[model samples]
Target: MTELHRIAIDTMSGDNGLSAAIPAALLFLKEYNDTALILVGDESKILDELRKHNQEPNERIKVQHASEVVLMNESPALALRGKKDSSMRVAINLVKDESADAAVSAGNTGALMATGRFVLRTLKGIDRPAICAPIPAASGHTYVLDLGANIDSTSEHLYQFAIMGSELATAIDGVEKPRVGLLNIGSEDMKGNEQVKAAHKQLQDGGFNYIGFVEGNDIFHGEVDVIVCDGFVGNVALKTSEGLAKMLSQEIKAGYTKSIFTKIAALVSYPVLKSFRQRFDHRRYNGASFLGLKGIVIKSHGGADDVAFANAIGIARKAVIEKVPDKIEEQLQKHLVD
Candidate 1:
């Protein structure tokens, strides 16, 4: 039998309450044979929600009580200073203390990022840690880093992100020599803002398969593997992509429901449409890994539903099994593509 990983998950802070995370946890546990979950939250609330699903947070899943709750409006430092007993704090401590292999949370993102760096700390040689989210592309998915973690990211910071993201693509996603690209305004090699232009020049000279600059439109085209950019630019790109996806989806829904004939046609194309919708779904990339941290810290969408929260826990388990952080350190030392 394979070894089961102990994953700590925060249940109190997502847009959805224990209602969503608990059920999703139950669903994932059913599929994963070699994994145990430690849920950190109001124990009674978690247990009560579990009972709602005719289950309990028992041995396969354990509960740790957290009294303080971190609100979304709280500042990163303020939340960290006072809410020591918050679910996010308890979850991070599990990995920091060797109690769990990784930690997953759907809480105040700012607090999670702050507490993760403070408690678990960054890996050696990594000036700043980054968040890697799988962006929708043609064939499968490509990863983008620093998606709002460090808004004022420097050029050296982006280079570090490239190293981190490439290793992840190869190790976890099985993408070898992941074609890297510098996110920019134009496809031409010598275009865009100074930071992007400089980063492009540096990557072009680097050891990886640096594939020049990729425009904003190429994100969904499946053209690149790892996207390199400062947090300010990367965050804008991510939000724009997400917003466009949502708007398109809503428009499609309206068109389909506009009339009885359209609804009938929609039923005929429902399966194909469903697949298309799932194709660009952000929920599929619900958890964003805080790469370069000593232990795994996955940040889920604060507004994530139950399905999203459960998927976040699943990501943490995968990181533990794949030995992501250790692999990141190993790959950072050497620039091998494979």
Candidate 2:
């Protein structure tokens, strides 16, 4: 029998609250038989939502009532102070207390980050945790880090991102060495700012599969497995890619339905178009791992629907099964000693 993994879900944080979260948890349960969930939110609402789907909380699906919620627009500092029993905070506490192997939240990103860091704390020698997610590239998916956690980071921080990212790719993507790169403007070693250059040197000698500087375009080429940058750059790249995907999907739909002839073409090519669309569907890649934390925390999109939130739960399960944090700490310890 497969070992069971427990995940804590913040059911009150997303835009649709229990409506979205309960269904997602059900969907996850239907698929992963070796996993259980702890839903954290208002008990009454969660129970009502579960009954809507003809479901009851079994031993595999338990509820932990949380008294409050951190609003999407609330400041992280303010939320941290006032929302002691918030669903997000309680979910992280489950992970911290070892009741759950991992936690997932579709809440205020800033508040989630702050609460996760505070509750789980960073792994030994890790200054700050980074937000990392997989992006669709030309050949396959590339895992990129520091999506929006630490806007400003030093060379050492970037190095830590590389180490964590490499371990993630190795464990999740099944890559042997995991080609890691430093995101830069140009390919040359001297083509970036001071921090990028310093990180470049650090990665070059860090002993992993470091493939020097990679341009923004290289991100989609799929040649690199892991790309490291400060939160500012990584977040901009991530948001820009999301915007482009949305715009392109919209334009394709609009263009295909413009006229009768185009409509016929669209019908004839529906399979190919759908395949292409699925390749870049953002929902399929909704979760971002909070790397470097002592425990696993997955940040889902605030507006994620049932499918997207289910994807977040899937990420949390994978991280727990792979022992991602322990692997990262092992690598970081080796680097620290050298």
Candidate 3:
């Protein structure tokens, strides 16, 4: 039998409260009885929210009370210290203390990233663990690294991220021999800045399935399963992609609402379009593993709704089952010196 893995979650800081996230969690809990969950936040409110769903806090539905909730606008460090008992902090400590196998947070991303890095610490041989976000693409998903985790990185770091990202795509995206791509300005061998040029050489030398430099235009073509870049560039690429997806979606909706005829057509096509849009929604792709952490720490989208937050919980559970952290350690252990 699979041992039940405990997951600690920040209950109060998502776009919606326990009302939505809890129900979705309850769905996961019902399906995966071999899992234990810890909801860290306002005790009374969480209990009440659970009660609304005809459930109550119990042995499996554990609670770790936090005296305060970290507001998104608060400084990451200041809030972490000043609000010592915030939900995010409590959730992190659960993992730090080994009370839980992993902690999933859809709170202030900056706080989650900062606190997780500090509290859980990095594993040996890791320079810095980057955020690996799922890039919604034409063919399933591709794992992109350093999605704003580190602003800068050395060629060695990008090489490490490429390895990690490739591994992740194999596990999560189910792509074997994930074709790795270094994000660059053009397809030519000599077309990028020093970082890309350097990373490309290292990736080739490192024995990864390097697909050469992929331009921004190729991200969504399902061309590669893993995309890597320094955090400075990767973050901008991710945000720009997200913004474009949103704008295109908005324009489609606006066009549908422009006329009664269009509205009628939209109404008739609601199910298909909704399903299509769901394919590209950020909410579905919210959970990004903080690769190189000792334990599983999934940094969710800060503005995630209940679906996204709940999806993060599922991602955390899956990470534990797959022993992703252990896998990362195994791979990196070779690089660690005496």
Candidate 4:
């Protein structure tokens, strides 16, 4: 039998709260034979939702009570200290205590990062954690890092991101020597600011598969397996891509049903259109990993629904099975931490 992955889920702070999370958990359990869930939240509410879905708290589906819920707009520092028993914190605690292989949350990004850092802490020799997620590309997918985990980072931080991202690409994406790209405006030698330029030098000599500097266009080309940048730039690129995908999807649907003749044509081309849509669907790419932490933690979009959240759980499962955190530590030790 395949080994079961125990995933702790913070089920109270997402857009639909327990309604979406409970259903997502059920979906994950049904689809992934070797996965179980610990639904962390108010026991009573969680049980009610489980019953609504005709599920009971069995061995595969367990409920761990966490009386409080973190607000979406709550201050991260305050929530980290004041809401010790919050669902998000409790979920992370499951990983710290070795009760769960990984933790998944669709909570406030800042609060989740703060609470996770506090509970799980960073891996030794790592300065800070980075939010890394897979972005769909033409040839394949590219893993981008620092997706709003830190606003300002130094050159050394970017170097560490490369090491961690390289391991992530290898462990999860199955790339042998993942090509690392430093995000910049121009691919020329002296194109970016001082920080990026400094990082470029380090990556060139650091002994990884450094692919020199990559522009934003390189992200979709899938020319590089891993893209490294500070959180500020990474966040902007991530959100911009998401918005563009949404706009393109809407435009395609709108153009297809414009008239009777167009609708008929759309019917004929429906299969191809669907294939294209599925290729760029952001829901399939819902989970982001908080890399550099001692324990595996996945951050789902706060507004994620059942299907999106289920994908998040899948991300956590993959991270656990791949032993992503341990791999990052191994890489850090192999290539001296900056």
lDDT measured at residue 149 in model 4 versus the true structure, 0 to 100: 91
Q: Which residue runs does candidate 4 get wrong by more than 4 Å?
A: 1-3
**Could you give me the TM-score of model 3 versus the true structure?**
0.94
In candidate 3, what are the lDDT values of residues 173-268, reduced to their tens digit? 567788999988888887887777898887887666888888776778887888898898888988898788888988998999999999999999
Q: List, residue by residue over 99-207, the lDDT tens digit for candidate 2.
A: 9999999999999999998889999999989999999898889999989999779999999999999999987878999999999899876688898999988888889
Best model number under TM-score: 2
lDDT of 3 at 44: 89
Model 4: per-residue Cα lDDT over 245-293, one tens digit each: 7888789889988999999999999899889878877789899999999
Superposed model 1: Cα runs more than 4 Å off: 335-338
Show the colliding residue pairs in model 4.
Answer: none
**Which residue pairs in candidate 2 collide?**
none
For all predicted structures, in order, the TM-scores are 0.94, 0.98, 0.94, 0.96
Tens-digit per-residue lDDT, 1-338, candidate 1: 66678988888887775777787788779878788888889988888888888887666888889987788878999989999999889989999999989888888778899999999999988989888888878878878988888877777787889888887787667787999887878787667877777777677767878888877777778879888777777789899888887888899999999999999999999999988877766777888889989999988888887677777777777778788899889877774333
Q: How close is candidate 1 to the true structure, as a TM-score?
A: 0.94
Better of 1 and 3 by TM-score: 1
lDDT values of the candidates?
0.83, 0.93, 0.81, 0.92
